[model samples]
Target: MRLFHFSEECSIERFVPRVKANRTNMPPVVWAIDEEHEFTFFFPRKCPRIVYTRSEGLTEADNHLFFGLTSCNIVITVETGWYDRIKKVSIYRYELPAESFQLFDETAGYYISTETITPLSVQTLTNPLDLLMARDIEVRFTSNLHPLREAILQSSLTDFGIHQFNQASAQ
Candidate 1:
């Protein structure tokens, strides 16, 4: 599967082959990113998606990889919303960093990073109703939460509902 890695220089469109043998079979697609790791872009696929996680080191799972190699614990969801008008929305950008050395057996001796929750509002297409028929308006921000996911999950129910919908559709 193809995954996007956001960086300052460029947004890497890496085509991680389903199999290790096909790694060298295809070239990757790279897009330029601004100084800030932020940009308004769309994947070639539908919204409410999960990209493969990033990892370092070796493991039986990593060694015997397939097209859908799960590594990082991150999931990004994109959905459409409506308020005064339709809004193209994306949210729930969560990153679960490796918590224990066992997670990355090869890098066990080194210090592992804690999970980070990055709440991102990638882009909002205004007046999206003209483009699509959907209407909803919900926004809130709160503190007292250690991670951003808690804040996000508490702020809006619409987003959470949409996330569930996406997951159901995928299955």
Candidate 2:
């Protein structure tokens, strides 16, 4: 399966999870469902440094299991798939117009999960409604001012375009 990541800069040859400004001490990696989601379009995703495959077609029960094993954030689209691959994944970058990024409702709640191990990951995202049906999974959505949203609003340039990605072999 092919995973995608986007960035404003073109220097990203490798997809490495980055430390958010609030949590610089940790070394977790993250990615989004696709460019369609608002959060993924606004932020960056990275593959870990381990050997694992992508987790796609997750059911509500599967989400509980996955969330229990590792920390993940929100779920936006039901079709979104996140991989646990960590073998230095290569990236193929494409240009995305800034207008492609459509923001979701900020007033709605969002999920936030985190893991501290080799498959270090963070799932900061918009609510994927299907994942909320699981009783065991606590889907705590946030309506606060997130860092990414702040960055988007504060930027002076409006003609910005994001660098979207695909696997190296596919390109």
Candidate 3:
């Protein structure tokens, strides 16, 4: 599969990881990042659908899955394959604009612009097929202000103020 971030000038790169299946063949699956941690899993050929989530309790539609440049607001397009048959497959594309999100977060506050890339792998097959599913996927978000960033910096400053006060009391 090919992924392009508009902020990256639509440069497509391979995000799927190399795998060894039965010492010869390999399969494709979905890849994503959760809480700054990387995860790879297999996608079923029949369904070939995967949803990524930032929080644990969110549903598939509620998940914040954005794609774009890492820092700027730019649109992105993703093209992947869909299963048509065991030997034949079809391609589907999805396009999202950078201005789609109203908010984003880096530390605690949300930003308007961000990008993330991940690799993917696959396991288990109902039948021996050479179909390529979306094994790896990248998500980029573009926004004006990041809520997470604000939260982290604010917490850091609060802790620093407390530490300074403690030092003065000791003296």
On TM-score, the leading prediction is: 2
Worst 10 residues of 3 by lDDT: 158-167
lDDT per residue as tens, model 1, 32-102: 22221111222211223222222344344433431134332322333322222214332221221222212
Model 2 ranges with Cα > 4 A deviation: 24-26, 33-35, 38-171
Instruction: Give the clashing residue pairs of candidate 2, or none.
Output: 48-86, 72-113, 73-123, 75-128, 109-141, 110-141, 110-142
TM-score ranking, best first: 2, 1, 3
**What RMSD, rounded to one decimal, does every model reach?**
18.6, 18.5, 20.9
lDDT of each: 0.25, 0.30, 0.25
Each model's total of backbone clashes: 6, 7, 29
lDDT of 2 by residue, 79-164 (tens): 11222121122233332222223222222211122321122122333322322334222222222213323332344322222222
**What is the full ranking by lDDT, best candidate first?**
2, 1, 3
Per-residue C-alpha lDDT of model 3 across residues 45-149, encoded as one tens digit per residue: 232222222333433332322321323122111113322332342222212232322233233222222333231222223321322223233322223112322
